[model samples]
Target: MVKEYYDPEVKYMLWDDFQIRHIDDLKLKVKGYSDDECKEFDTTEDILQFYPNFKDFIEQFFAEEELVNSSTRLNYLSNYADTKTYSVVATEQLTGRLHVNENLFKPSPKVMEVLHNATYEDVYLYDLTREDELAVEISKREEISTDHILIHSGSSDVIKTVMSLVLNKGDTVLISAPSWNYYKSIVELKMAKAEYYDVVPGKNSYEFDVSGLMSKARAVSPRIIIITTPHNPTGAVISASDLETIIKENPSSLVIVDEAYLGFSEQKFDVRHLLAAYSNVVFSRTFSKLYGLAGIRVGYGLCAPMAKQVFRLDVNPFRVNNISRKMAVAALRDEKYYKGLLKDITESRNFFINEMNSISGVKAFDSAANFVFIHFSENTDVQALKDYLAQNGYLVRLWTEGSRLAMRVTLDRKETMEKVVALMKEFLEK
Candidate 1:
């Protein structure tokens, strides 16, 4: 190993102190055993990695040694999400003037101006706004009134925030499977039990498991019923009628719809209209997906009583920056641009499904968003293809031990994805 010369007075810092982002750290290095023979262990065997644990090694490499759930994370790009690389991200201009990448952040240009005009803002400072004020505005989501919209650390906040609206600790949350993974995890994180109803996979991709979903929500009377519209992984959009039936049956439970993928939705269902019909219903929206502001992180919730309670809590403020807010507002304002993007991505998704379905060993599902989920031949290690794609400058999400060869393909409208599909078929043929 080569050693670098350093000043004697310079102090050494621990990796954890700098707060390196997880993805960046992964780029610098990777984790694995040099010896493949002992790569895996039995129950007592698998836990033996604890001696030279895989998770620990991964965290250490990423300088997140204390982070939990290291090995369990699948590369999100390859999952249900449209990992369409951010094409419109902010670029530094020679004039030093800034232009927002509408694909990646929220709160649009207008929102940015509003935030900048306000006294309470400092992008570099990671500032906070008054909870009661900002959260209070979130309350005016529908005809009903609510004041709560507390910001939390992750998508899990959807649950914690909504629970504050409708659930007490230890409340039951009914969830439908083949939805976003974080939805399941968030409910459990909030000191609540989760009831899952598996949807029947149909001719198309992750179909809404309507009958099962309704049956279970009725039985549990869960305090919160979470549904994903234009769902992740499955790429299925829940019908308005099914949504109506859900609210009609679960009178006791609050219905929380997670519209994380709605920007990519073909038909925009105005669920907000339902808030007029049911006091027990709310919708959660995030800028992460359609606006492509996954990193900037501005999520909005629409509710009546639920939002009212969210504003009163002592949560962090200005969690979404002027930049993110600016971009989001841009996304909302540019329906033409957003619509054009939707058309391209929808076409890509359809093309992917048709092409992949033609392959003998592959099964592709109908998707409404910018990704296509494919089940590969039996024992197909989708990781092999993912690794190949990554090597080809493409990043994908991978699923382990699923019903099919599970991998998520992002929409770039570039030739790369087409070639990727072709290569995958070639690999299958081999």
Candidate 2:
């Protein structure tokens, strides 16, 4: 039997401190776990063998870790509530990710049938420039020119590719406060600065600060400005006229309008038309949202002809997979299926907002997208409320901008949402 270097009973206790990012203390604790009686290995799997309980820790904690420069590091958000169980609702998901009960619609049966008939060999395509087939289809739907479209895996991939192709070192990028955090991290990864404009909460909904955005554009002269329609977390949108004005105001800068949730918005703007009118306008659309093809992972964008050339240079021949390509085409073609899902989501969103607002100290904003933005009164203990929700088997995306404690809660199916609202009411009272 191997002699243990550390007390076996207390070994697991170290994980608690490690989780809160006490790296120095964690390093000290790890040395004790190393046994001089056994051979040492540097590989993660081998290290896990010596520390058996570290399996899940390694898998979850370090998967998306980013080492920023020399001094800073990035850590992923924790999913404190267990996601596997039905009672532990995953309201944290911001995408149009459907629950099992929400599968009222699906991709066309013909797509699956065709896929079955299709051979694996036929899936590979030599065309690195996916410009003609799917791009043309997207152009037709978005009312943009074929030369302006590029098909990619998803919005995240598209954003990375665009950043790589467009930004230079020390250049600035502008995004809204409380927008997608990934955008800021990616901008930093490219060695560009990220500046944020504020999104002020209004009487019934959140409003974008178009003037503040313009002011920042003039002050920083950002290389790119990312404006998400039916914006993430807040569900606020910049109107078509406002978006065009911003583009016109910042003629030298590239303005990217992310329309990932546009299909679910109450007011859908045709920002694709700006592609033809402006040299620096880029509009991204994803099948992840209204199409309910989040798993398929297909997203495309409309940009200037010059931007397309840069994208071609940056991207490989087979950027998007065969299954994603075909499935996206099928999903896009099936308008009826998406329309049904949209109706269901819209109804649920409204119901959720109304129900949440009815609770004392809770202010649920009307949402244009699938998730609703909510805030608690000053008297309410926001962190305590979140803990209560998690303990009661409901998980939500909680965000803070200054003094505000907001929750971006996903609107599940009507039945599920009704139960969640009831819990919220009870929790608020408590």
Candidate 3:
């Protein structure tokens, strides 16, 4: 090689030889060959002669890489990796437990029947009419036109699609402090900026700082504003009058109202008036919370005609499959069952709040939604209490902001709520 490494007529042959030798070494390593055995291989063909199965592995590996990396977006996006060992252990310990913090419960028997009776065509076919069918059902329920409704896989998908369509680099999105985390992630993904408005602690529960939000909106003139009614963790709701005021003031900005938890609230307001009044408003809802179909991922939005036209361009025609559509429709039709469930949830929520407030060091806030937010005093052993709850087949969401500690427990069956409250009482007595 030192004497004739760069012959002009044999240059191509030399390059080919080098590549084959390197590939043979890689194959040997992949086959768990020792360095001594690898030294015996001079070419890919020679390695294949020793281990025939090695060729299939190398070919499949390269094919998978070629397929995955073919997308241009992958070059800039971060690659996902498995969780660390300790994180995995913690997750395993909490698996299959009562996840009260999710605000989830079993679906109606009618909805379960539809799922169980799914036909072969329902699963195998393309379901071209599923989205339109669901839209019609939603339109009838929401009192909006089918043309103004757009069905999506979930409310999160609605957010992602709308953000992708509207946001540009450096655009501003106004969000409330301690809003849904998905909003923050989606804003960052679109390379946009997020501006915050505070939700302060009121006399009863957390509430939106309307004047503060309006003041900021006037200053930033954000491209989009997200308002989550019966907002998560705190269960604060924005009044319809206040909502209209915000929309009227921010005439140019697109306003998104997230009503995912609205079904559980005692005070119900029709959003059709706002939708008819403003072309810049969109109300997004999901079948996850009250309907108990979170796993199926069915969500829809009521948009103004102008907004609907823009959204349809990017939304997939077949994004929601046949089975999901059927289940959502079934859930919507069985309103009586849901109403009964809501009554139970409301009762359980009131009981939990009243009981938790009776505890000396704990303060449970009034919630319009199906979950209660309980704040622990500074001296209380919050971590020990959480561990005690976890040990007794219950898992809740713990919220920490600076030195403040709170637990957000979803309203479960009356019996389960009674048991959890008793456990908390036992823990605090020590």
Candidate 4:
């Protein structure tokens, strides 16, 4: 009798009694599985029954295949929309695309005032002083010296510059699975080998599998390790103590912490002590999320003096424009405005998680950031629900893992959250 098995690692579907042992030359190497080695399924539905997480993606794959092979393809060809074009159309109609969590709130009025009052020097002349001025403001805020702060166009530029500076061909880089994903891409771009540690789902939120990370770090002795706090998509954070433990364990490796969502998280920890103790740590922060200064594209990194010196060699002295630097400085000084925004975000996030959890067959995880991660039970028609939400002018980020169909929804205004919850219930009832 023939049986089917799915490889979650490489997302391959295997037929017959063979299991994939490895890959070579773009082909899977298979060996017959022992009775105890693999789970067997007679049909795709049976596979779904046993592995709930694969249900959504597997079903969608099959559906798409059927659509392509059937008469529907020919009939629709004249007016067909490819996935990319369809996405563009859908995005154009969205009330707001919550997938990215771009701040709907405006930046501090001071930022606008500075931009409005900008002179020709701010636009045409070389940025000589503003970057230094912004660094001084950040140094005061972070309680770090100006020499240790590296200002860039955005945190992403920092990551890229660091990778370019540090990564040699075939150097091993360790990062968490289900992380920013861009980390993996950049590592590969540098011709470096990327190794992943796990980030497992927990009762209330996703958590770092720290022990697993340490194990991988020991085995690979990776040159760089990247950690994200108030982690993207999952909204989980690594405690400062745990972070220190990781840093202490791998003394030789450069540990980079992406704290782009810093102000949104409720958990507070100081990195000043860590910076004082370790020279191998880099903490990246951005004005994009909390300050609503994404349009300005200003970000900075706190690094040790030694690391800063090496990074400076590759960084442009005038990377940030004069206008952007001044605007970022303005955002920094308006603490009261940001505090009020943080309060509203916290309330909206709480309301969203609570309401989502109240729905049958749905689980909304607690988050430390401006978004919530939601999981739908196997029985839920997630694709249908996603379509319904999109039709109603809402858009969210969606993906699937073993036995789970999940989405990350950005917290918007309270009224928008209420409408979303109501629409979800309306879809479920139908």
lDDT of 4 by residue, 139-199 (tens): 8987888888999889988887888798987899998877776787677666788898988
Which model, 2 or 3, shows the larger lDDT?
3
Q: lDDT of candidate 3? A: 0.77
Any runs in candidate 2 off by more than 4 Å, and if so which? 1-118, 122-132
Misplaced by over 4 Å in model 4 are 1-94
TM-score for each predicted model, relative to the true structure: 0.67, 0.75, 0.77, 0.78
Colliding pairs, model 4: 52-403, 53-402, 53-403, 53-404, 54-403
Whole-model Cα lDDT of every candidate shown, in order: 0.58, 0.71, 0.77, 0.79
Best by TM-score: 4
Q: What are the candidates' C-alpha RMSDs?
A: 10.5, 12.1, 16.6, 13.9
Worst 10 residues of 2 by lDDT: 80-89
- lDDT string for model 3 (1-430, tens) is 4464665544434332333335545342212333333333434555797789998987898688767878753544443211111111123232323433444557789998997899999988886653367888888877878888888998878877888798887899999887666787777777788999988778779989999999999999899999988887788998888888999999989988888887887766567888777888888888888898888988988887777788878888565888898999999999889898888888888888999989998889888887888888776766567656765567666665444657788788778889999999998887
The CA-based lDDT of model 2 is what? 0.71
What lDDT score is found at residue 300 in candidate 4? Answer: 88
Per-residue error for 51 in candidate 1, Å, reads 17
Instruction: Candidate 3: list runs displaced more than 4 Å.
Output: 1-104
Question: Which lDDT tens digits does candidate 1 get at residues 1-430?
Answer: 9778874323443222122223354454433233233232323324543465666654566566324545665665334232222122222222211112123222234445545565544345654544433344444433334342433333445555656545556788887765555555555445567888765457776777778877777677788888877766666787888888888788888887777677676556655578657777766777666755566677766655555455436345435554555455555665666666666666766777788888887788777766677777665556556544544444556543233336766565635458767777766675
